[model samples]
Target: MAGWAAAAALLLLPLFAVQFTDGVNWEMVDFSVFGAMLLGAGVSYELAVRMTGSSAYRAAVGVAVAAAFLLVWINLAVGIIGSEDNSANLMYGGVLAIAVIGAAIGRFQSAGMTRALSATALAQVLVGIIALAAEFGSTAPSFPEAIVLSTGFFVALWLLSAYLFLKAASG
Candidate 1:
């Protein structure tokens, strides 16, 4: 749990920086969405840990998700991968693939745990859509606002993945 919290905090730093630096005031809905995701991830990870009793499995899943997301994020950030076209699609597809792989692995090792992870992953996808909608709505946000908002979403995901990692490590 602590590890997850730390990871969440670390992931949030970039968003906080963008918000503070750019003087963006976050809306209540934005905060609520991010909070929900954080809560969901934590709950799912805890449930999976309890069900599987295999810390290694939990950690592997957590690390895999985090590493994959980080890799893509870095690619986008450094201009190594995503350009203008299809960036969103590519990122979404990558995330979906990771979730599917995680689900498959979980199913093979522990059905209950896999289901929990899958549920969390599904929630993540929904949240991503919501974030995207929020971003592109009537009043399109400024670059800073968009950055902060997206960062918040990623932070929540990192926290959830960290939770799994810690559970695996401890077990």
Candidate 2:
């Protein structure tokens, strides 16, 4: 109930913002997508809570969910490689696919989650490197720096999640 309420509140924020400022213009589709993402993340965390008593495990789940959510949100809003329309942004789907597939394979166990997140971190790095090599966003002023910085941020999140899961597994 609290989670659902929080989701509603978050949804309402944009609605309110739009009324107050033109900078916050959001169409129906934006609200729908953001709502779905919030619901998905909430459901994921709820499931993790039901599955484990370990705080470390729960924290790991939280971090991983946040990372995934942010990845999608940013990709859709502004595209990692260039504009939101850039085809190169599609490569991020594979990074997410690895995490989903890995989690399913591990059955959400702490040890398995550790491996999954570690693999995810590696995948994130590889994707950034590939983008740089292929010059996905080379036309942009930021280019390689933006790609490297964003990739590092995500890699750190994934690594932290993996570390938390490792702690949970060993605890």
Candidate 3:
């Protein structure tokens, strides 16, 4: 119930922001997409909690969900590597793919989650390196620096999630 309430509050936030400023404009499609993402994250976390009795495992699930949510939100709102229209931004999807595939392969167990998230973090780093070397979104706003910072931030999130899962497995 709290998760559902939080989702509703977050969904309404944009509506309030739009009324206050032009900078916060959001169409129906934006609302729909964000709502779907939030719903999926909430559902996924709920299921994960059911699968684990460990607090560390639950925290890991929260971190993983939050990381995935932020990645999609930022990538869609404004291109991470450039503008939303930039083709380079699509590379970030690979990172999400790795996480998804890894999670499935690991069967959502703590040990498996640890490996999955660590691999996801490595994939994030590699994507950042490749984008920099290839100059994928050179024309986008904050081009190089923003890309570096975003990559670092996401990598850290993945690592943190992996560490939590590892702790859960150990404990």
Candidate 4:
């Protein structure tokens, strides 16, 4: 539940940042959003493993998520169904890959440690938002617009994370 809430907050961050300043780039925003989602997944996975005391299940879930991310990366890399912006595609794909690696590590390591790492991931998202806001200055009307956009985005992300967490927890 906490993990989902964190992810929800992260998803809203980009829109908020964007509304505050037009200078925000999609790559950075996407990186932050995906990073948060991955972090949430790790947290949920760690909790599940801790409760079940089964490393096999942890590894299985990690691998499955990683494999799915890899497929998405490939699709984006090849421009199969979306924009062909190589830089954005590569940036997003690399971030997802890193997340997968982190998940893999979490699966094999101590659950408590993995949970800590997941918390760090969530912190990174908040830090990114602060950095973006700082860079843009807080004087503009766009600041409010950004906040609204981010709120919506975060809410959606939170719901998604919560759903995923519940599903993973139950399984």
Q: Provide the RMSD of all predictions against the true structure, rounded to 1 decimal.
A: 10.6, 1.2, 0.9, 13.5
Give the lowest summed-lDDT range of ten residues in model 4.
79-88
In the range 1-171, model 2's lDDT, one tens digit per residue, is: 987898899999999999999888899999999999999999999999999999999999999999999999999988889777889989899999999999989988999999999999999999999999999988888787889999999999999999999999999
Displacement of the residue 113 alpha carbon in candidate 3, Å: 0.7
**Candidate 1 wrongly placed segments (more than 4 Å):** 11-15, 23-40, 68-80, 84-95, 98-171
Error of 3 at 41 (Å): 0.5
With candidate 1 superimposed using the best TM-score fit, by how many Å does residue 4's alpha carbon deviate from the native? 5.0
Each candidate: what lDDT? Answer: 0.51, 0.93, 0.93, 0.46
Comparing 1 and 2 on lDDT, the stronger one: 2
lDDT of 2 at 11: 91
Q: In candidate 1, what are the lDDT values of residues 17-132, reduced to their tens digit?
A: 76677664446564555555556556655655676657666664555455444535443443122232424434544554655565566563444344545455554455456545
Q: Encode model 3's per-residue lDDT on 27-121: one tens digit a residue.
A: 99999999999999999999988887999999999999999999999989987887888777788899999999999999998999999999999
Instruction: Give all TM-scores, in the order shown.
Output: 0.40, 0.95, 0.97, 0.29
Q: What's the distance in Å from true for residue 48, model 2?
A: 0.5
- Candidates in descending lDDT order: 2, 3, 1, 4
- Global local distance difference test of model 3: 0.93
| Worst-scoring 10-residue span by lDDT in model 2 | 77-86
Q: CA lDDT of 59 in candidate 4?
A: 55
